[model samples]
Target chain A: MSLILKGFGKVLKNKEILAPINLTIKVNEIVAIQADMEHMNAFLSLVEGKRSYITNEIMMNEQSLQGCEDLFIYRPDMGEYKRLTPEQCIQFWCDLYKVKINIDNVLALTELTHIRNKKNKHLTFSEKKRLQFARSLVQNTSIFIFQEPTYQLDLQSKQVFNRVLNEILKNGGIVIVFTSSLEEGVRMATKVFRLNSRGLQEVELGDEGEKEAEVKEDETDSLIENDTVYQRKFEKISAKSDDKYILFDPLEIDFVETRERQTILHVNNEEFYSTVSMKEIESKLIPYGFYRCHRSYLVNLQRVREVVVWSKNSYSLTLDKGNEQTVPLSKSRYGELKAFLNW
Target chain B: MNLRLIRVLLLKEIKDLIWNGQVAILFVTSILMILVFFTFNQLEFNLPGHSITMFKGIPTTLSFIVLLVTMYVQGNLMVEEKEQNTERLLGLIKVKYINVFISKAIVTYILSYLLFVLAMVIHGYSFENFITASFFTIPFFLMFLFLGTIIAEASSNTIEVSLYGWPIFIVYFVIEGLIYSSIESRFFYLFPNYHIERGFSLIEHGEFLAVFNYIYVPIIWMFIILFFLKKRRKNSKTILNSGFS
Candidate 1:
């Protein structure tokens, strides 16, 4: 399941806010948003689920494991609310030691409350920066871009953000933070993408600043390298969010990746409750009955419930869930769903 | 609720509320002044057209809540984002700014009215006859809030929005006073005060007030203000800079 972000850019309409003219940040890359007060809302519009002053009303309603993925970016009074204390951290670590919970689950902090207010509440500048950094670390998704992740933060918080950002990169993720001060950006980012008068450009960093991206000692790397299980688990790996992970486990996860003519079926969690890929689906369930319905979707020849006419020239596919999911019935697949499902 | 973003925005608002604590103090003081119209120094619900008087106070509280909070709170919305240069940050993450706005209004209302209610309670006022059923003032409250937010968003000078909010206050007061004096007139219908009258009349008659402010003045004015702000963003390249209030 390879997801691609085609074209994304940000343009500032104010002289008060000078941005790197135009830039494209892929998924999983941590890209920092840097600007003064005027551009904050515009930058905020990028992540908000609703229409904002910066952009149009397009929204991505998917759930992200990154803590507080749905939170508005510019709330100022957030500190006045509440937070889980340092003591809470001790308690959490104790629980983790006891349960041996996966780091991913713990990082999500699903039950997080009071710590994040639905409305704006009071917070110090440092607190906000720290939280943003933590969010970057916990998000196990495609590319991250932090726009000035270290602005107005106190010293300790800046250090913490820097550490968390490095951790994100070390975890097989990409991160890019924006800064007017090249020194700051150079210090913080691993892969710096500059968006000055020139369209978007990229720059790789040398060893400098916080070394959080490193695995601390040679032991950690050797532990994984020497472990036969870990080696066998990862073969040909590609990009991943929470939903789509490439074939990492060598033996059990054999796949053929090519831009080929073979029909590839996509199984998304939204309409496709059946988590099996088209090949797996074709083997055990819908044998002799699957086709690449669309570029981003698949259909089981045996389970399609209906083909509702979409327009004079197109149609939609309804499935076992009694839910209708659309697929362009290009003059090609019109007769496929019905004859295949035998309905 | 992302703790980071919320913390950033919330901190700024508190800084603002405190910086302009004078507005809050003045607004509350005005409410205290209205306590003069009380039937007696002591608490009593006895008076001819008692419902009428009580009905009017409902919108008054809402409008004042909207007015004063707007005076101090409107600038706190997307203003800082416009200033600190982070709106595009918000856009990139795909945040819901309206929720931020609504949440901000809610917090402001809760804090302001918490104090207002405490003042009322301290003075032996009773919630028993409060606007339990009438919702007329709700639209008026929302209209004021949305319109005020729009003005704050579009203001040329950021400092003037908070320091000299009297212009906004004066316009609202004049409109409210005229509408209040002629509740029966069609002119007041546009004032949101008219809706307050209707809602209060129903509450006085013991009817259900609506639950959706989204359907009332709040919703209408919210869309109106949002439209203008969006329009301004499109019409002028400097629109985003002007929003830094």
Candidate 2:
């Protein structure tokens, strides 16, 4: 099934809030749209048929979306009954949809089985989000729309969300995520689009060949002085965990940072002390999409998700690893990084 | 129209009411008000025939309790749903808004009826009259439910519910006073509480036809309040709309 939007746009009080958006989403396809909060809310309102738009229409599988809203399950950022337990919340959704799904399975899928009996008000921020996800899962709708699915969530909760998304795709359901974070959009969806006053535009993530060519160009200039050029082989960075030396592929490392004069390698969610200095490691991993974002921080460019700007002088790089690791970005390096990314 | 969905929605409403401490307090207060009114009726008076009979005072007491229970309970339910945004969630799940309305109304009606029966038993009223009173008071119960819905739709939270609800409730008694006084105005007939009082007085006199005559007024008020509810529901904005604006 394909969901198509034909020139969907909104104008409030003669002021353009959202530009016309034309797009098509198909079954088993996950789409993420990145926009500022104002445009995001307006776009979501237009899609949910809550706000009247000046132009365009939405159709799902050749049928108008006006009366077929049941086919869409929208999980807003926050809207669960605080008094109800996770199990009760899921059961309520199941009964409302008039479907008999396995409540236990849903609870398990959301990793909420342990807290199934606890009231939602008592749940932590991540658990409440999981409860909301479970509620959406039980509806068994063909289209799932989530707003900031992983906002302020822990690593485990993000993993649970990833599994839930896979389950929906495996069931042949279409998923659309609307987020203000570009990193979240790229991390959660296969096809990511940026929406703003300019209209909807697809963000082209370069192919493997293009990335390899860029890396090769950088490597050629640096290696020209070496008389004996050796064929590249699989390389791994070595770090010491207690007395044992562990070898990790460069791609496995989220970032490298020096703490108290000790170079540390962060992989997954674990920290390992690297015997090599930060400068040496940075030079070796440069061909593998690594960037020295800060004086003491070498971040894997492939794992960098967001460049968060707190103020004119304060900036940070959020990594796409578990728990969303962040490293400080020096002001001097910020311009170079931006220019490299062509942003 | 979906019975299963309605049942589920009813169960949710019942659970919500049970967990809400404020509603529980109001419920307990209603019971206490009945007992207090009953005690006042039993005490002897110095003036002969000046003492009120339990039968005569119970209907008035029950009417006030019905107004309190139905309006507070129904209004609390709707406002809480709107405040917490579960109403939007239910809409997303495609649960018909009418089913939710029916569920909340049923719960409020049941609570009001229970309070009425309890008040009758405390005052030693007969079961025959209990059935008659309950049947005749159907329109008033519905009127209160619709009024509660209107108050909730107009407010965003419990604080606002009381802001809008209590004044309208106090006005019911004020209208009742005007109906009993020398004031001869047709506007007093427009209030449902006025018709409710007239119908109760007719029932006391065993004038069933006159009771039916007053019944049409409250019934008309019910329809009018229902129209307002429909209009409010149609124009009600979702939480996202608030963010957009």
Candidate 3:
């Protein structure tokens, strides 16, 4: 089933929550929407059958929201409330949806087989999230609306969630992910929409050059050459400190970390402080071979030597230079970093 | 209209009550309260050479018991679903809200009636009195069950429901008692159980038509409560839409 929002506008108490939005989503398409937390929640509320638009059209499978079977499945992010074990919860969902039981496959897929007998309330946040996903897999739902599915989850558990998302997409399900993080939008979506006070707008991913159309003789060849030229331009970045400045090779920097709101540049044997915030530095350096490994640390992709999993959810990245300088890696961004490294 | 779904929901309610030990608590308390009140009434009023009327004190005791059990069971059901946020799960399908509401009312009514009859049996009321009195009293108790549902839906948690439900329930009886002695206003006719004892007295004397004036008051209260519930449901939906607490 496909979803189409045509001039969809939502208003609450004389204040417009969502301006007129025009978008069409196809089956198997994973659309991630990034916005302020409040607006994001309002949009999710509409999607999950909690609210309806005041003056617009929303159609799922060519039908309105009311009595639409195609919009049957909506799982809000709620804490575990059932007194039953995870295994029983999965079975109950299967029975409720009148689907066949595939408990073993669900347990194995979520890596929750070991804790299958534990009551839902006793499970950790990630475990409970996995149990919810397992329950969803047992039911036959055409569209999956996930509100902060990765919230408060470790990187490894996020990959488990990512796998579940991929499985849903593979089965031609509509996946709508709502988050407040732009990194999450880049990580999960092929297309992203931004909701702000001004209204909804499409967010273009990748280089500004890619967004423009070139009327060259060879359009395909020109596109390839343009990408390579864009890549060559970001080989190095300059920084300033104490009335002195340096045009340093970005590859020579092992990592850039933020401490106490100060952005510190980390080289092999030298450190330079920048007045710019980490977010400012990140935007300038991301086009280069730099990857944000954690909220505090951004590493030069060429300097990363090894990916280490110290524990189930704890991880670190070892740099190739400076006696194998170690940098803390966030679990939330670990999978994206590994994918960027192709490791 | 889906009988199977209604059956499934009713069973779920019963299972939840049983698992939570509410049913057992209500059952044992009802029997014990009956025994205590039975003995107390006999000793206080059944003096030497004087005949004690079984019906004298039964209505008041049963009314209080109905209030307690309805708030306990129906209130628990309402707050539990809202607390756990499982109410939305039911809305996932095409089930009518009316069906859901009626199903809960049916289950709660049956449980409350069972408690009443069990207490009546232990109090040693005659079968003839039991049959006729229950026929008139069931509607009055059903009104209480509906009010209990409104209390449950209006409140957020178990503690909040009980804290609010109990005071209003007790105050209702107090007002009714005051009205019975001091007021002859028609506004008192708006109450569900008003003139219930008088209606029963008329029934005992075979004055059947006079009972309609008493019974019709509860019918009006039912419609009024249902109207209020429908409006509250709309308000809750609006609150949900706004995504505010």
Candidate 4:
């Protein structure tokens, strides 16, 4: 089944709140739409049929979405029966959806089995979010919509959500995520779309071009010789964006490339400008399995999913970050990458 | 209209009430009022034209319990969902609003009647005309239930319930006092409290047929409140979609 929206838009007081959007989300496909809070809510309201649209049409399997809402399960960021225990909460949802399933299995899937008897009000924020995920899981609907599913969750909670998301997709369920964070969109979905006043458009990941910059040979040779000792100096790489500094773990960096003489660290399709030179950053990251695929690109070997050959001398390495995330692979380094992997 | 859905919702309401400490306190207050009234009747205080009998005052006591428990419990039931945002989940699940409303009304009705029976047993009153008394009180209970729903729908939280609920609760009794003072006015007939108090008085005199005469007023008030409840719910949906929390 496919969910289709054609020219869907909202207007209030003769002012366009959301521009007309058209998209089709097919079964077993995960799609994410990133927008500001106002537009996100406006778009969600339009889809949920809570707000009237000046011009729009939504259909699921060629049926109007107006009266076929039961096929969709919306898991908003906020909303839970705080007074009910996790088990009771799941039971209530099961009964409401008229489905019978093993409640314990769902609790364990959400990692709330340890606190199955705990009231939702007493659970932590992440636990509550997992419980919400469990509630939607029991409904067993055809389509799932999530709003900021991992907004403030810890690493462990995010993994749990990813597990549930995989379970749904494996069962042929269509998923749509609405978030304000682009990184979150790319991380959770294969097809990431951005909704703004300009309307809906798919975001092309890893399409930014890189520029070569001269690196001093003496500085790189010295760091490469003592890379083991240099690796022990720091465990996090510091990058700057706007007025704030962010420290990212080496494992989180998908790849790094130089653009216009500035080193940029790419993590989950987002770029952070780095002050360290390419030679020093590559030496520091070499021990962590980073390969200098090109003069302008340093690719994390652990995140490389496939090596694509465009021609004899033209090649690119696809990183497993999201759809179409590829970095330029220099033909000279192709033999080295193969030998490094023992191919 | 779905029986299974109604049953599931009823179970939810029952469990929620059991876990709520505030509602438990309301139940305890009712028991305490029963004991207090039972003791007062035992003393047999006799003054000319001021004698207090169990039959004469029991209806007034039950009416108070009905209003207090129904308003506080029903109002909290609705407001707590809004405060916790579970109402939106209910909407997403496609649970009919009528199903939730019916479940709450049934719970409130059973709780009020149980307290009324306990009050009668403690006061040593007979169940000879209990069915007639129950019929006379049904409309009043419904009136307060609808009124409580209106207040809950208009309120965003429990504090707002008290803010708006107490004043209206006080007015019900104040109006009852005015009607009882021999102040002849058709305006008094507009209030459900007048019908409730007058219906109970008719029951005390064994005027069962006359009790029905005062029932229509509360029924009319209930329909009016029901209309307002529908309108308030529509406005609430507007507020929800407008992102005007």
Taking all chains together, each candidate's TM-score versus the true structure is 0.42, 0.74, 0.69, 0.75
Q: Model 3 chain B, TM?
A: 0.80
| Candidate whose DockQ is highest | 4
Model 4, range B69-108, lDDT digits (tens) per residue?
8877788777777888877776665567777777888898
lDDT of 4 by residue, A1-343 (tens): 8988787787789899899877899998889898888888887776666443223277678676543245555545557776778999888888888889999899889999999988788999889988888866787677788877877775567768878888888788888898876556655776778888888887643323212133355555667667655435768888998999999999899988765468999988888999787777887899998988876678899999878654454466767745447676766777888888986
Model 1 chain B: lowest-lDDT 10 consecutive positions: B236-245
- Candidate 2, B196-229: lDDT as tens digits: 6677677666676667787788788788888887
Quote the lDDT for B228 in model 3.
77
Better of 1 and 2 by lDDT: 2
For residues A51-156, write the lDDT of model 3, one tens digit per residue: 3423237777766655333454445445444556777667655645668867898898898989988866678878888877675577676677676676667556
What residue pairs are clashing in model 4? none
Residue A170's lDDT in candidate 2: 84
Give each candidate's interface RMSD in Å. Answer: 11.6, 2.0, 3.2, 1.9
Better of 1 and 2 by DockQ: 2
Of 1 and 3, the candidate ahead on TM-score is 3
Q: What is the DockQ of each candidate?
A: 0.03, 0.46, 0.17, 0.57
lDDT of 1 by residue, A1-343 (tens): 1112223335546442323233433434455433344454444344332222224222232222232233323244222212233223323323312333344432333222343432223444565445445444333354454555555564456556555654554565555455653334434543454453333455433232113313242345556456645423212323343587443221122111111123222233221122233333223322234454432234554455556553343344545453333333333455765575566
lDDT of each residue in A15-38, candidate 2, tens digit only: 898888888999998898887778
What docking grade applies to model 3?
A: incorrect
Which CAPRI quality tier does the interface of model 4 achieve? medium
Q: What is the lDDT of residue B236 in candidate 3?
A: 72
**Cα lDDT, model 3, residue A241:** 72
